[model samples]
Target: MVGQRQFDERRTLDRAREVFWLKGYGATSMQDLASASGVLRGSLYNAYRDKETLFLRVFDDYAEQFLADAAQALAQPVVDQALRAFFDFTITSMTTGVPTRGCLTTKTAIDTKADGERIRAALRDLLDKMERLVHERLSTGEARSRLAIPPAEAARVLITMTRGIVVMERVYQDPERLRATAAALIDALLTPVDPGRRSQTG
Candidate 1:
């Protein structure tokens, strides 16, 4: 059985995560956290010491779980299929829920500042991991002559495009359009060189 302290901490952390995810780091206040966490303000301070520190804890937990799930989903052997799944997951995860809070990293990229360097660094690390996984997937595609661009270049393009897509979805609130955009991106990345153009150039 979970000890009371451990259980209380977990509950507080999860509540804080939800509040931050929905409202963002800068906007979430101490009272907001205390209310959402169902802990008294005094007890909240005693447990977490301060709001920013509690936020960091919540952000770290969210990032860890998000990356783990993403890594598994992007691990499909086929590059095209894996990318399609990635886009689908990204869209659904960001758009389907109420309030439509986008990816936490994507939100932080827009909302955070120098004061939140820890969160920013963690997000950068996650993006780097994403790029590495995409590079590997593209490398496999390149081996089969399904990709013309260098895997490294394509990986960078894909990760950047994904970030853009996530941001755009928040403003547009159109899932179909975002899905199409992601699909086009994958198609462009995987499109082979035209044989006629190659022949003429050769």
Candidate 2:
């Protein structure tokens, strides 16, 4: 019985996540969650107390999955391969789904109508985790002389590019173009930096 309940909860959260992604926090309601998840409205209220609380739970679930995916992508022995894996995951997330729903965190960050401090806090926590994960990977790569860019600088560039990619994905909705852009950016960043040459400093 306990196992079944746990499975049901996860199923509900997955459906809830889809609804919330399709319709922002402001628009989604208990009825929306209930209908999408096929769970009783009273059951949802009893489990999560309120819509905000339920959304937070769903958001946390997303955070966990996102972090795990990042960690997996960065686990490759070669830095280049690791980065490619990460970007491939990112691009897949952006391009997948029926209509392609960009990114949850990026959309949440830009949502001006999204109320409450808790939502902002959740976004911050997830973003911080991502920043740390990317930075750690880059730092390790730099130490091993696998990357020419400084970890701190490269982390900032990569994170910023991630946000930009999210935006561009929505605007262009072209998987090929997005992949091409990411490839070009990776090539530029990975180019060897000659310190002795008096041309230009990176």
Candidate 3:
């Protein structure tokens, strides 16, 4: 019985996550959550206590999955391959599956106010992890003479560019344009330091 309850809870959370993703937290009501998750309001309240608690739980699940995907991208043998994996994931998130859903982290960050300090902090930590992953990749790339700029700087720029791209996706929603931008950004970042070095050789 306990196992079945747990499974049902997760299934409901999955549905809730989708609802929250599609509609921001401020806009999602208890009734909406109940309808979307196909779980009774009484059960949801009994399980999660309130809307804020359930939203946080759903956010936790989203963050965990997002970081796990990042870990996979970072696990690639080559830095360029790792970066490509990261960009691919970002592009897919912005354009495919869930349309017009720029990013949960971004949406939450933009929508939340002083009351959402905890959520903001959690989002910052996740972004830091992403930046660190890029930094680590660039550190390795630097050793191979693949980068002209400092690893830290490159990572910062990449993170900034990625965030910008994510925002732009909400307005533009053009996959090819975003892909071109990503390709250009990668090319610029991977360019070698030496004047004589025309390509990424190593």
Candidate 4:
């Protein structure tokens, strides 16, 4: 019954995201969004038309923030450090929330209906954006032994491993093990120029 200006749109959308993230797109209902968002069901429908459309809005919001975080992680001075920061961010983000907490794009990609083309397209766009971010970082002239692979290929490998780590975090729920694996992956992939000593992030 509240007026549009009276309602907190961002707050409502954030709550809506929580519901979708927890219950998933298939299982969640508009009423669920209303309850979680503290907005009337009618108001929500009026604004977003349908759950698919509403989810698109919420997912886009999430993607913006997610990409911003990834960009920050990849902003470290050293390439290896930047890569480690990215993995650390991923591990902390995926593992901190409740048991069902995982990558939203990843979870949605797996769970959304086959006919959900719009959602699928959004997911693909987000993945491509992430790969581009990594590629930009990898293309930088950070010193010390870097990957033999091309920046584009290395970015793909990093993104693929990141998704795999998301799956691992969901299944294993072991943080230390995941960190160790990240370290090993980094060691295997990034070689030190000096060989004897490693270059630290500045």
Q: After superposition, how far is residue 141 of candidate 2 from its true place, in Å?
A: 5.2
lDDT of 3 by residue, 7-46 (tens): 3878898999887777877778989999998888877887
Please, what are the lDDT tens digits per residue for candidate 1 over residues 36-140? 988888777776678777877777788678767777777776677778887787788788568787877787778854257776787788899878877877777
Where does candidate 1 clash, by residue pair? none
Cα TM-score of candidate 1: 0.84
Local error of candidate 2 at residue 165 (angstroms): 0.8
Off by over 4 Å in 4: 1-6, 143-145, 195-202
Q: How many residue pairs clash in each candidate?
A: 0, 0, 0, 0
Least accurate stretch of 10 residues (summed lDDT) in model 4? 193-202
Predicted candidate 4 versus true structure: per-residue lDDT over 1-202, tens digit per residue: 5435457889988999888887788888999999998889988888889999999999999999999999999999888889889889888877767664777777787884624889889989999999999999988776234777778888898888888887888788897788888878777777666634444532
Sort by lDDT, best first: what order?
A: 4, 2, 3, 1
Q: Give me the displacement of residue 70 in model 4, in angstroms.
A: 0.7
lDDT of 2 by residue, 113-199 (tens): 666799999998987788788889887734346455777777778777878988989998997887788777777778654466427
TM-score of candidate 2 against the unseen true structure = 0.85
Number of the top-ranking candidate, with TM-score as the measure: 4
Worst 10 residues of 2 by lDDT: 193-202
Cα-based lDDT at residue 35, candidate 2: 94
